[model samples]
Structure formats: C-alpha cells, structure tokens
Target: MSNYRNHFMSHIKTTIGELLEKLEQHNWRHSVYVNEPEDTSIHTVCFVIDTDSAELENDVFTPSIAAQNGLREFLPVHDLQGVREYLANVGVSGTPEAELFAIMHYFKWDTYPSERELAAYQ
Candidate 1:
C-alpha cells in the first residue's frame, strides 16, 4: 500500500474504534461491517444501513456534519457550503466519475463534487 493508503486506513480504524467505544460506553451493543470497496476502479467509502436497524437507518436520513469538514479537506475547493447544491446542479449520478467522487468522499478523500450537480441548482 502507498503511504497515503496506510495513513487513510489508520485513520479509518481509529475513527471506527472511537465510534464503537462510544456505543459500548453507552451500553449499546451493535454489529458493524467494515467492508472494502469491491471494484478495483471504485474506491468507495460506504456505510450500508441495515434497513431493519434503528440506529443505522436513523443515520441515513440525517445529513452528515462531518461530511463537510472531511470533504473540504479532500476536495480542491476551499469551501463546502455549495457542494450538495453543486452536485445537484451538475446532474451527477452513478457515472464512474461521480461514483468515484462519492466513494472517495466517504473515505475522506477529496475528489471534487460534480459540477453538474451544482449547476442545476441555479
């Protein structure tokens, strides 16, 4: 693995560990799956919600405050304020580039948000 890969994995493990510990501290037991991206071309950082699980499902509907902070660091842009709107305007979808951006962003990698998603907002 490249140094970046190792560093990123370390960050991921640390984050997950902290999250799991918080759950345990609250006397909450949970199951977690740390899945790696399957396709070689797609480096998706994903969290799949088990639709039946209350916590995970609740998480999905909520916007991620962390997403903006992490996204700003990874993307070339100096700001995150307009990203979701930008993505919407740009018409970003499941295209490979969009997929990569989504996946990488989840992993805290800063691929720029799709311009199409942004343009449509105006």
Candidate 2:
C-alpha cells in the first residue's frame, strides 16, 4: 500500500470510529472489493452502519454494490488487516475478534481480495 493510502485510511479509521461511537449502532455490515476495476491494489472497504434490514442480508452492502446503490462512499484500505481493524473499531463491544473471523470467512467463502505477487520470472 502507498503512503498516501495509509494516511487516508488512518484518517477515515479515526473518523469512522467516532461515528460508530456516536451512532451507538449494534448492527453493521461491510463489503470488500479486491482488485477494483480501476486499480487492483486499490481495494475498497465499505461499511454500513445499519444492516438490520432484510434486503442487505445477501452481501448487498459490499463496496461495489454500496457505491452503485448510492448508499455510501467506498472507503479504501491498504489490506485485509486494515479492513478488519476498521470493522473492529466500528463494531459493538467484543466485535473485533468476531469481525476478524467473519472477514476471514468471507474472504475464503467469496474468494475476495485476491493475492497479488510481484516478482521476476526466475
């Protein structure tokens, strides 16, 4: 991840954490978009403060979908860890560990945030 993105995510992480506290929301959802159409490394980490609605149950709140639906802006993160930490901070108490587990499960189940290897053909 570039330094600029790191800084950006850091800023948003703090802002979102504050938002989560102020909202005092228990239900939240997130979507990860790895390999963005525009830039592969530019993975998007999207979060929805409210997800109790039935319509959002099917991973409909993902980054791409959220952006398309005009629900929220696509927040970019450097890596899966960044996404996990952000979710942890925004989620209700004791949700960080759970968020990490769920994120890993989602990545495995959905095969997202595809790995990228850069090396010479040796």
Candidate 3:
C-alpha cells in the first residue's frame, strides 16, 4: 500500500478502537487497512458490514477479499458525513485521519465497493 494509505489506515484503526470504547459492544472490530494496486495511488479503506449483525468479541482483520490487509468481513469509511463535509466544502476543513477517511470512503466506495451490503462508515 502507498505510505499515505498505510498511515491513514492505521489512523482509522486507532480512531475506531477509540470509538468502540463508547459503543454498546466495546469488543467489536472497527476497521482494517491494506495497500492498493499501483494504478490508484491515492489509497483505499474498506469497511466491513455484516448483514447478520453478529457481534465480534475480538479484533477482526479480513484479507480474503484482497491481497492487502483489509479488516475482516469488510470496512467502512469514517468521514463523508455531517459537519465534516461542511468544513471541507467551506474551505475550513483539512483535519487529518477522519477527513481523509471520509474522502476515501466517499470516493473510493462510490467508485468501487467490495459489495453493496454495507456502506462506507459515512
């Protein structure tokens, strides 16, 4: 994976880990990251979505879908929603991590999603 994507992926994982602490299930997997093909230099973040809604008690990393290390089951974008969008549109945005995830989630998923069952975290 590109260094940029790798950096952001780790960032999202950390963010999700923190988010999980506040959720009902503090033990569910949040997200995963991996390098993408050279064709797209930007990067890719895949959010996992389980229609079954089963609870996972440990950290999950799903790479079966691709060669890079994406979170298990699926991945989700953390941005692309609420004030964050407003901030970016108004030129007052540029927060790292979350903002980056939002952009990737919105563009990446929109351009190509592993499956339609789940949406980017946004």
Worst 10 residues of 1 by lDDT: 1-10
Off by over 4 Å in 3: 1-41, 50-52, 58-79, 88-122
Q: State which candidate has the highest TM-score.
A: 1
Number of clashes found in candidate 3: 12
Q: Candidate 1 versus the native: TM-score? A: 0.25
What is the overall TM-score of model 2 with all chains considered together? 0.21
Those runs of model 1 whose alpha carbons end farther than 4 Å from true positions after fitting are 1-33, 37-47, 51-86, 109-122
Candidates' TM-scores?
A: 0.25, 0.21, 0.23
Of 2 and 3, the candidate ranking higher by TM-score: 3
| Candidate 1 structure quality by residue, lDDT tens digits, 2-90 | 12223212122222223222322221122222333223133323221122332322446322332322311222111222333345456
